[model samples]
Target chain A: MLEKNKLYTIWVYLQAEPLFWLTLTIGAFLVGDYLYKKSKLNPLVNPVAISILLVASILIATGISYERYFNGAKFIHFMLGPATVALAIPIYKQIHLIKKETTSIFISLIAGSLFAIFSTYFFAKLMKLDIEIIYSMMPRSVTAPIAMGISELIGGVPSLTAIITILTGIVGASFGTFALDILRVKDMTARGFAFGLASHGIGTARAMSRNETAGIFAALALGLSGVATSIIIPLLFKLINF
Target chain B: MLKSIFIIFLFQLIGESIQKYFELTIPGPVIGLILLLISLILTKSTKNIFITKTKEEITTTSNFIIGYLSLLFVPIGVGVVMHLSYLENNYIEVLGVIFFSTVLTIGFTALLMEIINNQFKKHARKK
Candidate 1:
């Protein structure tokens, strides 16, 4: 039989409001994901869009503090590490293809990383953004934890970095295919690599839905871009005096 | 299933130990991933075991988890609420940076990918 203490803990979690929020968020995402899989009107079915709407509506209606929601939502956060690790399984399956395309992957990553960073920096300067804001924006293309760390290192607001990262992911997931078509990017490898490099995990998720090869390349790009950005952003900040 | 979970935890343990001991720039989970990959490659048989065992669990868990991943941002977003004053003060600059950086990152990545695709095709033809 379960102990009294364990029962209490379970009861507390069951009563937690954040759990409800998380459930709603997950439910909405599943609906969106299912719809995307079933229909060709892919843009409207974006899980991120649905999630943002659900959460925003809840927040507006209840006036629930983000912290209150986060208390229950952190269970979902803890899974990110394991989810990232699980990416290795898909990556392992495609190891043979990865080896064959090592050169292209290398070139793609280097070019993609540089272009992502420089263009953000260049455009921020053109727009006359404050130095701190520019620094915060520098790591926007990478995944969240790394982006937050880079923002802190380069004197950008971590909170702002988080917002930008989400926006980047959603936009990437939404318009990524259209962008590829406009550029006439037909190769699966290039499409996947570009998506992952530009959009991180969310982009990789979209890639996985496309094909196995694309998924593998996307995961690799996501991991590599995260690592590279963490190293490069701080150095670039120092060199450029941002 | 239990064994894969054990292996994952063991790898995570090793990763955390390395991080605690050396204080590396990389996160422990990432290091754990690398270590697991290397070990799996070394004992190739375990790769089959690991995949077979965790296949279904990982798929279901990944599906359930991916949707809620965005909620992790809520805390950070709420931080925006707490810092309304700072945001108001720096509103224009903050909004400008977010807008331009996102657009430019997408544009440049797409452009660079096209060039790389063209070069890759050329090299493939030579081969």
Candidate 2:
């Protein structure tokens, strides 16, 4: 057995640095992503889910606080902006198709945004949920960064928005294709638009794997949905006094 | 490889500049995308770029990045750790809102698209 003095020294050193937590989070995520891909369960195997599990396990076992982990993990968070920017390349490729379907895309985005906002508010009221939780849930379908920002603006917890966003992605990835088929969405544009509006990036990924045309429309819808939701949700909230 | 990297950076730079100068609500990458689309349209007479070796390279690169895209959220997940108090307080409301809104959004968007597509088809038939 190790001596008590030596064990205490090691524990103190480990607790002092942020890199220890950062490495664990990223390493676990990469491993989880690889294993999930290899397992062939489904492309819907959300890496975010696996990463959350891994981190939660580590936190519980090691008695490390979340604040310590975030101290170093913030670097990875910075990449989200660049990644979103990179999405432009794919969207640029489908500009012509986007131009042709612009009207329909606009209409769908408006309808979708309204539905996302009102339905959540309505359901929260029915369920007797608190006002803050309703505010956080309002931006669940939007991308995480934007959702987090919106959550803050609406007096909800940004962290709750993040969790809600992940759940939305998982649900979108799992049910999106089936829903499309059940609804008999035959047109490639409509299918892509539906996926993007509903699931955001995960749904867009599903669309990209199917066909180029679908991929293009998915990108357009994803970008447009973000813009439309950002504008419409805020305005609607004010108008509705929620 | 070098050319693709250069083009991406150039577009990103242009996008960032536009966003900074104009205070547009649209993100920089989006503006860069519009620029690229304009360029592509103007050069439509040129041969398609996706036919050659470059297509293979791009597809491979994009696939690799897309595969791990979800992993990039770990940091954000970690950030959520800081918000546990808020989550504990608002869990029910949050879950309820997300579930109902997602279902409604999907249903409404799909219906709207169906209507628009039907209208377009009807117009085409009339023409």
Question: Model 2 residue A206 lDDT?
Answer: 58
lDDT to native, each model? 0.68, 0.68
- Candidate 2 DockQ category? acceptable
All candidates: TM-score of chain A: 0.88, 0.80
Model 1 CA deviation exceeding 4 Å by range = A1-19, A38-41, B45-127
State the lDDT of candidate 2 residue by residue for B17-89, as single tens digits. Answer: 9978986555666566566556545655666666345444544554455544566667665545445566676
Instruction: Write model 2 residue lDDT over A36-126, tens digit each, in one string.
Output: 6676635456566677778877776887777676776766665554455556556656667677667888788887777776777788788
What TM-score would every model get versus the actual structure? 0.81, 0.77
Instruction: Encode model 1's per-residue lDDT on A1-242: one tens digit a residue.
Output: 46988987875665466667568656755766567768764754675565556665666676666676667667666666766665666666677777877776777677778877887778778877777777777888888877887788777898777766766676676777776776676677777877788887777777777666776777788888888888887776668755
Clash pairs for candidate 2 = none
Calculate DockQ per candidate and list them: 0.32, 0.39
